[model samples]
Target: MNAPPAGLEIRPLTIPRTIDDPDAADFIAMTHVRNLVYAETSGHDDGRMAPAELLPNYAPDPAEIRYSWLVLLDGEPVGRVGVDVPQEAGSRVVFWLVELRRSVWGRGVGTAAYALVESTARAHGRTVLQTWAEHPPSPGDRLEPPTGFGSIPLDHIARFLQHRGHQLEQVERISALDLRDGLPRVRELCARATEAAVGYRAVQWRLPTPPEFVDGYAWMKSRMNTDAPAAGLEFDEEVWDAARVARADAKIVDAGRTALVTAAQHTETGELVAFNELVINNDLTEATSQYDTLVLSSHRGHKLGMLVKCVGLLAWLDIAPESPRVLTYNAEENRPMLDINEAIGFEPIGYEGAWKKVLSDPTTAGADTADSSDSSGS
Candidate 1:
């Protein structure tokens, strides 16, 4: 095995209750690095979030076990590691990431950090490890997954993953819509979708979900794991109830972020068959993020997906008037959703690869680590 860099130390991260807490110093530094890494890789600051706006996501939760570490070189923070294990019964899936600054590339920092991620998953009996990374356009060889809908440059990040036994299972398109261009096309699409969705109507609300819609919303959230196109990646079928829904809402609100949920309800049965989410940071001038958008399998063919997305974007304009743009992601194979996005003026901004590795033996994790001078940004 290759030796890790000298003076490199991986220490557990402490999530403070608030930004004002005395123990928040490390958290704040980590948040800054996180934002910097994202901006450096994506060429935009849309993913930036204040420490107060990011702490709630790292808070303790019952449905999943999360482990994080700060990678320090000579006692100075340089990178971060994360591993997430779902609480679902018989779940063997573990999601992880090892993000470092470009300046730290070729020093074996990422490889060393990845060792920790692998060990954590092994300890938790998770054999299926998965991760996603943004690969900005680069001129070089390209790699395509089995789905054949998108490709990513076989650059530093790809080589690192390939050397460590990970396979590229899928590619996702990162898309954005300029709110400055106005929502005329979106409005037109919404009208057509509304006419096509004969028996469904759009219902909208802000985060502490209304009492009447809580159960339906929870049901759709659970379906997100099963209904989405995951290619070869594995996702636990999440269990969501009113309590879980409340916890999720609290996380967003506590982070000083606002979430708007737009769902399509069946008129006769009063079931929320489809839904979309739009979230904005405390500063509305920044870009808005389009979160989960899903329509139940049984409710397909009614144009509900387009209905919810168009309705959500239109409503979001009024909610975040100053927000510059809206960002979103979709599996390349999800053409129906992509069609809607394209029709409404959302263009492809970037692409990301979804990678997976199945450990044949827990004890042998990262034993064949590959030597690469590449940085994996968050």
Candidate 2:
């Protein structure tokens, strides 16, 4: 895809995280605007990570989230994005997240960059690419999202995804796990477990995911992924086990994000039932540090979720005691999980909607032709 007219130039942008600025005011102003944009669009203002985290992600064994971009003309940064593509052993599909600057609406930056993402997928011969998003603000919604967390709407971004033949297949809610007051007792944490009668057990899988278990982990992912709540699911739903998990690790570290934390549970039958993850610095959106969590259906009855979650919760909190929260998203309709959330004091912040388009390439589907032949032609 080519750039549209009006003196627009779309070039991949880069920044060095190691450098510091002498213009404290401009630096702070840029950050403030950046933050303002964030609160307006995504709903949170990440004031941490000093203004320098906005650089090329190139660290070894990186955090869980990663960023890459394309800058527009006029230099104020029209559109840039962060992607999390780590290869973890037990995962099935490759995932990505793209955040755009709203100023460039109607511009081609999104279309072009989306094309690039497609090109990369083609290069790898991958089956699907997954993205997570929130519902858009309402008609009379204010510019600033409230202090809590919520789903960003899919209205605006959906147009782009729909234009590309993407459709919403599922929706998940994002929730935060904060340990600001320190973790509750282990017994208190264990009270939520559903494992006793089911013979299921949960435990935190430590960093440096053990190599011997990779293949089996990859095997289960295909059957494991629940549907995405929004459109544009681009990965194959296949059995995942160890190899998939390994890919997640390599993908993140390769992109300068870390995949250092995880928790999982197994039945006495040795079936992998539940899981959640805590990233050291993969995501930098919340003013305080945060992490992501995942739970599977097979493990739902066992209270393994709370059990598995608490491990990673206390784990990250133990390491970065200064951090405020660990973030996770559950489907808005997911009430059982919400029960566990309320017990832990995770508050609501913002809300996002999920949408999907079932049709693609409308022209390919055969459009009705307009009658251009006028009687005057006779």
TM-score of each: 0.98, 0.61
Q: Model 1, range 1-378, lDDT digits (tens) per residue?
A: 346889998889888888999999888988888888888889999999999999999878899999988888888788788899989999999989888888787788888888888899889888999999999889989999998879999998998888889999999999999999679988899999999999999999999899999999999999998999999999998999999999999999988898999999999999999999999999989999999999999999999989999999888888899999999999999999998899989999999999999999876655756886544644
Work out how many backbone clashes candidate 2 has.
74
lDDT of 2: 0.47
Pick the TM-score winner.
Answer: 1
Candidate 1 TM-score versus the reference? 0.98
The candidate that achieves the highest lDDT relative to the unseen native structure: 1
Worst 10 residues of 2 by lDDT: 369-378
Off by over 4 Å in 1: 374-377
**Model 2 misplacement above 4 A:** 1-5, 12-40, 46-69, 81-99, 106-172, 185-187, 194-198, 226-235, 239-243, 252-267, 282-299, 358-378
Q: Cα deviation in Å at residue 157, candidate 1?
A: 0.3
Superposed Cα deviation of residue 319, candidate 1 (Å): 1.0
